[model samples]
Target chain A: DAGITQSPRHKVTETGTPVTLRCHQTENHRYMYWYRQDPGHGLRLIHYSYGVKDTDKGEVSDGYSVSRSKTEDFLLTLESATSSQTSVYFCAISESKRLVGEQFFGPGTRLTVL
Target chain B: AQTVTQSQPEMSVQEAETVTLSCTYDTSESNYYLFWYKQPPSRQMILVIRQEAYKQQNATENRFSVNFQKAAKSFSLKISDSQLGDTAMYFCAFGRGTGNQFYFGTGTSLTVIP
Candidate 1:
């Protein structure tokens, strides 16, 4: 509810195609994260950005990539999407690095890869 | 890697009654943080409560409180007065003080029936 928005609330695409998800924040937070949620798997981190041009891979980053050219925008791209990548993706932002655990999330984007 | 565990897959409580959700975590570091997040059907992740490792006193927010046992590495959430709106998927998270990553549990689906 902290001015975070995830585009493409729902998308269905064929496997082996490229896909991109966008996360925009109006608060200009210093930290941004992308997570994927699946049944019985809760949520797993895909990638995160500490600042502009500063990114890091998370536990489940093998099929995902991220970019942050500005403080308010973070992008997650899936190159040659696979059926395993179908899940609900969420975007979160935090104001302080010291309080990274406390994040504000946007409405998730549900993606289905066939 | 830090791990969070929520053994209970589903819980139900009557409206206006009290309920508790169990959460246990494993971490190698002495100092770390614990958190409870709520994911409604809308798929937005909301922070329910937080507990600091260094603090002995439990943290409370309105009808929500946490019983944090640092020695046992247990952090449970107590909802004093449950409501229908409280029905959601609750996730336990672990955040190491030195790392920016947050490890999440599989989640517990809570149902508050009136």
Candidate 2:
């Protein structure tokens, strides 16, 4: 397993409340990503960071935002939580820019928005 | 944009038997990569196997192998001598050589019966 950890392994928040999930890595990988997993949607990228302070939006980034101030950490925040955002969130890291490089994943965080 | 599709939502197989999971993808890029990931009840995502689009030979790992047909845009996983630990949700993913994001399929839940 990779030395990756996601804080607040399980969280329950009410609608319209602000929430943030943290992903920390010890591998010092150059790339980090955030993804949401749902019943019918296996996994949809929320955001990704190529380097410190360099980030890009993904397919389902409408309700989510992210920040990467340091190499070891990537954060995902929801300004106002929504029930539709209740799902399992995963963090992944890759050592190289090549697509063939294996991406290591964190255990995941289960968030429930009421 | 690239899309990965897993037609089988659920599959069952007896322990020690062989089972195959189907996956198909659509992409305009010629150079890319494909992967299969396993998520157990513990909610941890594990990389099963990987195949490079430019390679003509398929990739194999231990008891797991991938039948990658580049022209057909198909990448299927074959598990031999399956065990109970193999029971999990399997996902097919696509990644472009020059891109950072990955596109994943809905997933196929596999149950290894005793």
Cα lDDT tens digits, model 1, A19-56, are 99999999978889999999998899999898999999
* Best lDDT among the predictions, by candidate number: 2
- Runs with alpha carbons beyond 4 Å of true place in candidate 2: none
Root-mean-square deviation per candidate: 1.2, 0.8
Candidate 1 lDDT, B42-91, residue by residue in tens: 77788999988988999999999999999898999999889899999999
Position A62, candidate 1: lDDT: 96
Worst 10 residues of 1 chain B by lDDT: B94-103
Clashes of each: 0, 0
Model 1 bad stretches (over 4 Å):
A99-101
TM-score of chain A of each: 0.96, 0.97
Residue A85 in candidate 2, Cα distance off native in Å: 0.5
Highest DockQ scorer:
2
Deviation in angstroms for B44 in model 1?
A: 1.4
